[model samples]
Target: MCLNSLLFFRCLDALVHFKHLTSLIADHNPITENCFLPPLPKLDLLWLNHCKISSLFPWVSKLKESCPNLQHLCLMGNPAAPSYFNGGTFYEYLQYRLFVISQFPSLNHLDDRKVTEDQRAEAQRLYKRPFFERIIKPGSGSFSQLVHSSVTWSGFQNKLTTLLGKDKPNDRNLMI
Candidate 1:
């Protein structure tokens, strides 16, 4: 924190020790939305994967002006929220100025790495198309990766049309 010596305190019952804070990793939890790591001047590594977060990646970017020694930051596996996914279903590189990278200039490692094939497939099967599309068309690519050529895609769509039951998504009703 900007404060020189506030001793230590807790926020919303989240344990935070400011004096020796260095590495913090709290992934796959809902509490991160309310937790704040006040510009930990000594922090070096931060991991925030799958907090169900809708906003901010490597959020420590906000601490660029203060944490000059930080070396690693990770913010991966955020959901389909607009702020998390941008325009693509997959995570891509950030286009904006990396404030933290600029600050720590030495900060060369970001651990928000990519996913595996099985991971991607599992994700697609869970989120994108309804269950029927998957069962009827089975994705053209490996079950884990969903990439269909035009021909296969059309076939998959047709299969979906034929199999869509009374509970199909509203968009399916207007498909040409």
Candidate 2:
């Protein structure tokens, strides 16, 4: 159902009734991370563009589990998606795409573009294992502790640069 421009400000818990919903367009709403949509096994196209999704971590994982068949997801204007219009650099946008594509390997389309072969390959290379799964290894802290920690962009960038082996002189000092 098209629930666009409804000014929905909280979790859409009511949508769990539509177990067979194949598509849901809820763009232009102020939906936040609290949205607790339940499993929709048939959902393929979900357009939450121009909403207020701010982070990708829990949200991506939740959606991956809830909408396993989802193939097309448009989150263009959301902060989580990261684009030039939202003050994000092209590198950030590419990283966002890589992260999403890596998480949703079955996804065929994202935002306004199709998933390309090169992008998929790069995603695989970047995310050999799920991002969250890497948070705990031997003696590392729990994922919740990491989540509540003060995560700075520079620190994240430094780790990513090290992982990609793209280290440059003083690169760790640069913040996106």
Candidate 3:
């Protein structure tokens, strides 16, 4: 069913009772992560391309639990376009960095193209380190603790540069 262009209506709580919904095209709506509070067990195709979605990490991460049968997803025009995360196009960034295939193992078609087994395997291998560092082996300190740690300003900048692969100017020194 298509529910596109509904400006004010963001929540889908009322649709939770539709247990057998197989396809949902809710594009051009103001939907966010809160819209899918309850799972849509039978949903197979979901088109949520152009909306106010800002971060795919948290939103799409819950797709497996929210829509177990989802095979096709179109998140093309969202603010969290994969290109913004890296210097490549959305598809390339999605394939290498975010590991979209790994995140949604059940997804067969993303933005209309079929996902190949080889591509899935490559994504898993390429993003293994990032996945482990971000999710599995997060830094030991709590948020505040890490923020207030005694590490020098330059040290922090160096670490950030290393992680993000950005260059730091050699002429300037940051003091805390």
Candidate 4:
């Protein structure tokens, strides 16, 4: 079926036992504001780059659970997915792994590997909005609490950059 803003995700979710869904470009659409992964049970090669999503990489784990042979995940041009890492902590590294291992355990390359200042600002802009603060899962506390609990945007800019400036590439093959 032909996909557009209203029916794309609905169609994708209804497709049972999907094997692969590559390069899903859903830009310039209103649905990108929320999570809209296609839920491919056996998917591989996702390309959600530049979508204005606000999930803390939930699809990562979902894809991992479905696609055993998955590789290459992309989430660029969003505020949440940092473009360049100023620094990361042991906790950040562990959280990244935990989020991945649980779902994208077999993923090879996660695209959009850069966290620039503007992206952080962009992410901040999204966070600062009134809708996001009141719309996400409750008990997440206020915006500060959620940001701190999320990925890098959580909190650590102070020590993160100085702490992980020399750290090596984190390559852990997790199995969750």
Worst 10 residues of 1 by lDDT: 90-99
lDDT of 2 by residue, 112-146 (tens): 99999899998877765545544345366777787
TM-scores for all candidates?
A: 0.41, 0.73, 0.62, 0.40
**For residues 26-96, what per-residue lDDT tens digits would candidate 4 score against the true structure?**
44333343443445645556666555554564554444555565566665554445444524444544444
What overall lDDT, based on C-alpha atoms, would model 2 receive against the true structure?
0.79
How many clashes does each candidate structure show, in the order listed? 1, 0, 0, 9
- For candidate 1, the C-alpha RMSD (Å) to the true structure equals 15.0
- Compose the digit string of candidate 3's lDDT tens values, residues 43-136: 9898887777766556665766778777897876666545553344645455433356666777888875788888778656555454224321
RMSD in Å for all candidates: 15.0, 7.2, 7.5, 14.1
Pairs clashing within candidate 1: 121-144
Pairs with backbone N, CA or C atoms under 3 Å apart (clashes), candidate 2:
none
Quantify how close model 4 is to the true structure by its C-alpha RMSD in Å. 14.1
In model 4, what is the error at residue 96, expressed in angstroms?
5.2
Q: By the TM-score metric, which is better: model 2 or model 3?
A: 2
Q: For residue 50, give model 4's deviation from the true position in Å.
A: 1.0
lDDT (0 to 1) per candidate: 0.47, 0.79, 0.64, 0.47
Whole-model lDDT, candidate 1? 0.47
Arranged by TM-score with the best first, the candidates are 2, 3, 1, 4
Clashing pairs in model 3, backbone N/Cα/C closer than 3 A: none
